[model samples]
Target: MTKGEQTRRFIIKQSAELFNQHGYAGSSLSDITLATGIKKGGLYRHFASKDEIAVEAFNYACQIVGGKIEEAVQKGETSYDKLMAYFRVYEHAAESPPFIGGCPLLNTAVESDDSHPLLRSKAQESSGRTLDGIREIVEQGRASGEFRADVNAEALAMLTLSLLEGGIMLSRLEGSNRPMQLNIESYSSYLKQFCLK
Candidate 1:
């Protein structure tokens, strides 16, 4: 990649962690510069404004989720297993960074609101992609006869995200894993229902 592309990517990568951990509003350009060891002027060379960098950070955050989902489905014996495996993998990764932020989608949703127009759009787009992925997995399960044809794939996708994200929020706020594990168990039970013959 060109130097300009590399710098842009670096800025986004550094900012993703910062914005996810500290929030977009709380993260200043100086924090980014200090973390990256790049000067403020250097950061501006790649991003026009902090808002632009925030948008890019949101995309980077979304990409990590995309990669995790892709990895989770690699070894499933069947479509049903694949769907469940995706959630299970995410459950384990929940303690890891990014996910521990209680989901980039929820984070950005509450943080961006309608104020950060570009960041809000990024959050919306990322969520749409995640929903599409879950639906695709469910569609595959139906094709394999592992899931009922009557199931609402779209609704299930939304539910999966809701359970996981909501659980994370409660867990983070309480600074405990009890809430998270409870939601994981609940989510797994719902997945089991889909696996019924």
Candidate 2:
């Protein structure tokens, strides 16, 4: 890659955590400059504005978290195992989140809601992709006769995502992994209802 491209990536890598930890409005230009160790002029050279950088950083954060989820999902042989593996990735989110701050989708959705249109749109797209993936997994399980034929893949996928996100939020707020653990246990039990004996 060219030096300019490398520099832009470096800026995104460093600024990703900042944006994840602090919302677009909460994260100031000075904070980004400090995090990236790039002067304001240098930043402006790479990004047209802080909004552009924030968008890139949010994307970067999502990629990091998404990569981890993909890796875990790939390790499982069965659809149910794959779904469990996806949940396991966030089992210790309060202590060791996939990304620096937490789930990028959750953080961005909460912070960008009705405030930052661009970021809100990105979050919406990312979340839709996640739900689609989970739904696909459930559909596959049903096709394979692993899950019951009558399983509502869409509803189950939404429920899984909601439980996982809510677990992460509660665990982080309480500074413990108990909430996530409980969520995982509850979800696992619930998932069994859709399984074929």
Best by TM-score: 2
Q: Write down the lDDT of every candidate, Cα atoms only.
A: 0.77, 0.89
Model 2 scores what on Cα lDDT?
A: 0.89
Instruction: Score residue 4 of candidate 1 by CA lDDT.
Output: 88
Residue lDDT tens for model 1, 35-77: 7999988887888898888887887878786777677777777
User: Candidates' TM-scores?
Assistant: 0.88, 0.97
**Regions of candidate 1 where Cα sits further than 4 Å from its true position:** 92-94, 98-102
Instruction: Give the deviation of candidate 1 from the true structure as CA RMSD.
Output: 2.1
Which lDDT value does model 1 have at 112?
A: 85
TM-score for predicted model 2 compared with the true structure: 0.97
Candidate 1: 10-residue stretch with minimal lDDT: 91-100
lDDT (0-100) at residue 128 of candidate 1? Answer: 87
